[model samples]
Target: MDQYAQLLAALTEAGALGEEWRGAFERAPRSAFVPDGIWVEDSDAPSGYRLLSKAVDPVGWWAEVDSGRQVVTQLDDGRTDGPGVATSSGSMPSLVASMLRHLDATDGSTVLDIGTGTGWTAALLCRRLGDGAVTTVEVDPAVAAAAGVRLAELGLEPHRVVGDGLLGHPAGGPYDRIHSTAAVQRVPLPWIEQTRPGGVIVTPWGTPYANAGLLRLEVGERGRQSHGRFVGDVSFMWMRAQRPHAVTAPDRPPDHRGPSPLDPDLAEENVHAAFAIGLRVPGVRTLHTWQAADPSGTHRFRLSDDAGSWASVRFHDWDGADAVHQSGPRRLWDEVVAARRAWLEDGRPELTRFGLTVTATGDQHLWLDDPGNALS
Candidate 1:
């Protein structure tokens, strides 16, 4: 089989791509959407990414494009000589297919595609539902223009808009389906307003502590409210506006020091526990690291709010109890311990069992099992 066909077959076997989206995937090959210059992760590189040019290394470029991994298209929001943080990427093919499948769009379904990225997603939507049925919005003008060019190359022209996706392009709505490639801390009210009543909105929703959950919300009658569950796990670039502020350690020494009541590793190692804790504890970021010079082989787990609060726990090989240090107004370590206790008391539910409800006014309530059982 050809490379594209092989990919399709693999995705089909993996259950990421369904037969319904096969034609669309076939029509819009990922290679056509990928740029000539892309960044790949490198451990030794100072900025953690090494740029590869198609002109200089066509074979390597093709390999990366064809691979299952996401292709980083822009770094530091298009800053050439800036720190190599990946700001935009062509999402992993399996993830793209899986999200499209969950979208469950049908013939004549009008879609508002948020975060155009490489335009590959818009192309796929256009192929499935026709060009007129797709309207894609991108925050970055340069990214939008480049994606538009790629879409044109594929003979696909979805109404392209250059603006913040949070304020969705209302002119294209009330759309039947709203799909966002970017992750959001909270579902935008504009998205809810633009989607027709009974329509669906599929996007990655998560907290600052853990950014992994594919949320699928079904709009309520009259478009006043929506309810949905985290159908799957997905990690996507945060919507530029909603991206969490950098988590920096407080300059001063820690104020409180004691033995941790709970193992810090539990919060870092368990995904469900992490998700649950993130829901209960707001505005906290978790980090795990080890001291290179520590002779005792200590593992450090740190928590920060990017405000003035910070916490650190050190786990040594011979530990009676891990040492905990907290500073600032918020006792982050204590909050995490309490959140984890709550999760366990609630029967340690998986992330998928949790769901979200949002009203027209953007009041969000997270619940367990049913919408009525709202989390405090």
Candidate 2:
């Protein structure tokens, strides 16, 4: 069997590709959406990614396209010279299929697809829902134009839009289903507003602690609020606008702070603990830098946000005390420790046990087990 056939067969066998979307997947091949010159993320390389071209290596390129891996089509928002941060790509087939399966859009239902990357998702939706039933919006103009061309070539015409994905395309309004291909910090108010009452909105939800969780919300009759549990773990690129603004730690003074109450090793070993920590600590991004030269296996966990707040915790080992440094209005490292303590006190809840409630006014209340008990 060909690569596409093999992938489809595998996905079907794995139950990732539902029967509802099986014919659409076969009819609209993923290859049509992927560009010739694409980049794949490789940690082995110093630059983090290596470019692959259909012209240079058709066999390899074809293999990647048909494979389940994500194919990066753009880097650094189209500014980088080589192998920079991946800005966009054709998402993994299994992930796409699984999300679509979760979407569970029925016939005659009008759907809105956010982040039309490669337009593959839109194409599949068009094949399933028919022309004019699907509307897709992309943030980047160049990406939108490229996807439009590909969709046109495939004879699929979904209302292609070029604008912020967070702000759902209201022109396509009152959609029965709203699906975002990108990850978001919170459920956008515009999505809830644009979705019809009782409609479904599915998106990859990320917290400050970690880039994970697939949120499946059912729009209420009023369309002003929605609540849903995280269906599964998902890691997708942030919505372009929701992406973190440029923030870096400035030079710190030669002052020593108290040791962090939280254990870095505990957070590192437990994904759920880390995720819970992130949920409690809002607007901060965490990064850990390992010390290669240090014989004691030391590492520094840096926390910073767009608000000019920054903190760093350096630890030589899990058992010993770690040095903490802060040089901002907000004591981020302290906040993380407090949150971690709270999480531990709460018995270290799993990601599935958590839920989110979004108001039309943009208030996102993260709750534990029940919406009534909001996490503070």
Off by over 4 Å in 2: 42-46, 81-83, 254-256, 295-298, 318-322
230-318: candidate 2 lDDT, tens digit per residue: 88878898898788654454566624466766666665457678788889888888777766897356577777876867887776644
User: Which number leads on lDDT?
Assistant: 1
lDDT of each: 0.89, 0.84
Q: Pairs clashing in candidate 2?
A: 209-278
User: Model 2, residue 120: displacement in angstroms?
Assistant: 0.4
Per-model TM-score on C-alpha atoms: 0.96, 0.93
RMSD of each: 1.7, 2.2
Q: Which parts of model 1 have CA positions greater than 4 angstroms off?
A: 295-298, 317-322
Clash pairs of candidate 1? none
lDDT of 1 at 84: 80
